[model samples]
Target: MTATVHTLQANRAPSLEPMMALTTSGMNAVNAVILDRMQSKVALIPELAGHLIAGGGKRMRPMLTLASAALFDYPGTRHHKLAAAVEFIHTATLLHDDVVDGSGLRRGRRTANIIWGNPSSVLVGDFLFSRAFELMVEDGSLKVLKILSSASAIIAEGEVDQLTAQRRIDTDEDHYLQIIAAKTAALFAAACRIAPVVAEAGEEAEDALDTYGRNLGIAFQLVDDAIDYSSDSATMGKGVGDDFRDGKMTLPVILAYARGTDGDRDFWRSAISGDRVADEDLARAIDLVRSTGALADTLERARIYARRAVDSLGSFPAGKAKSAMIEAAEFAVARAY
Candidate 1:
């Protein structure tokens, strides 16, 4: 397959049209409702949680929570609880990720760890995680609890693996996929899968949503990795080349190092794996990635996952919910850039 797609967003319109419409929908009372529920329920955490959430999120996970609930024609309002639960889980991970990566910025602002200190950020992340369990238990659903619990464990394992594997050039595409699936895709898969149970659907709807979530999660991470190589601080929110300085081996950089000639191999050894990469060497790394066309190739690979993610949404009937789900998948790849 060719390793370039000029416009992934444009191509995704027909399949993910529903999900894309939501990006234009804007943040509104849905958040107000969620915040009210959160205050009444997890009062103290909401103080910190509100700060983390009250910004420009696409609400993709919460959308999955709602879409799945809507798909089964749910009569009750527990899906609201579940949607908040999704955002809480997502937010907690971001807090923890900043601590782990020592990230100073996220979503175009100072990271929670940077503002609150790693200790507070880590503890707040724990509080939110425990809050999720508290909410899940109130639902009294064993299946929902199980799905989320398993996803959490896998996410931890993926993060541990990533920390251990850093600077290890032997790592390949499969390893990268595995780590992203566990660390990033786990909650997404769980969020979609548990939606049917909240609506009390049978096994089939549950299975389809599970599949959709898994593929979408994988696609999201791939695009995230690609963006680290190509995007700027304004579009990405975080520092450009932040991943490189932190010694992250994202798909584009990984591909470039592997396919490059002997000099390129030496460059990776000296710059990426070395103690401290000078400014000149860092710029060289960017050049090598561009010359190797890995950025375009990685972007193209992300496109494949985007297609798979939206295609998984096809099992459901056509409607606003389905369209939103598809567009959300496309947005994962397109993001701001």
Candidate 2:
């Protein structure tokens, strides 16, 4: 059998602009709700929330919720509030994550935690989480509340699991996957699944969308991990090797540690466990990851999940929304950052 070689450089997936265009109107509503609900007499609440919200993320999660609902031609406006709620859930997580990670930058700007304080960031995250629930209640659907609430709980558990696994070289691929699925993919699944519920699209459609989101979420995180070791700060928004310095047991590190020689393993352990790592150490770490083929393998794994995400949409009818969704999955793995 002929051998096949894969490279991240060769993957040119379509942009997400088309999907955003498809849901532009719905997204407008979502944004409006986000702005409206973020307001408070407290003043600082909106300032802190708006700082992160305006900081130039793609808002991919809420877009997915809106697009999935559009896939079913959902006429109800409840999805607008639901999509805002999804964004609040996502933003809240980011705020809390920065505090947990002691991150200085996000989207190429200082993290909220750094600007305000850890206490402010955590409390604002709590506020957003509570606001998300309020929107869910306004939607008047117990099912929506159940799905998002479950996702929130799973995300917290995943964060704890990752905290425990941090700097532990023994952390395996399965454990890493479990962490990402819970911390990240759970929300993606809920965001997509909720759309069909609001549309009354029945169980089959709901299941299909759920599968799509779950797989896409996994692919997205895989690429994110790979980029942490491969890209520059300008391209990646956050600092390159942030994961390495933080001792995150992401897939690339896991694979490299598992496949490396004894000396290589020692280097990984020392580099990751150190209180502070120099630029040279990060460079050496990236070289080790590249030489072990871990980066390529991680991207290849992400490609598999992206394919699965697209395949999950097979049961849906052909249309603009469906095509955009398929492209969205492809974009998940193929994005540069």
lDDT of 1 by residue, 1-337 (tens): 1122222344333343454344232224346545664463545466656767775666777777766666666667676666666677777888888899898777776777777688878887887777777877877778888988888899889999998778777678888888988998888888888878877777877877887888888877777776666636565667667777777777877899888999888777655675556667667777777889987788788778778867766666665566567667776677725
- TM-scores of all predicted structures: 0.86, 0.95
For candidate 2, write residues 1-337 as lDDT tens digits: 1222222234454779779999988888899999999999998899999999999999999999988988898988999999999999999999999999999999999999999999999999999999999999999999889999999999999999999999888899999999999999999999999999999999998999999999999999999999999846666789899999999999999999989999988888887686548898898889988999999999999999998988888777777788788888878876854
Q: Number of clashing residue pairs in every model?
A: 7, 0
How big is the positional error of residue 244 in model 1, measured in Å on the Cα after superposition?
Answer: 0.6
Which pairs of residues clash in candidate 1, taking residues 3 or more apart in a chain or in different chains? 18-323, 18-324, 19-323, 19-324, 19-327, 20-327, 108-237
lDDT of 2: 0.90
TM-score between candidate 1 and the true structure:
0.86
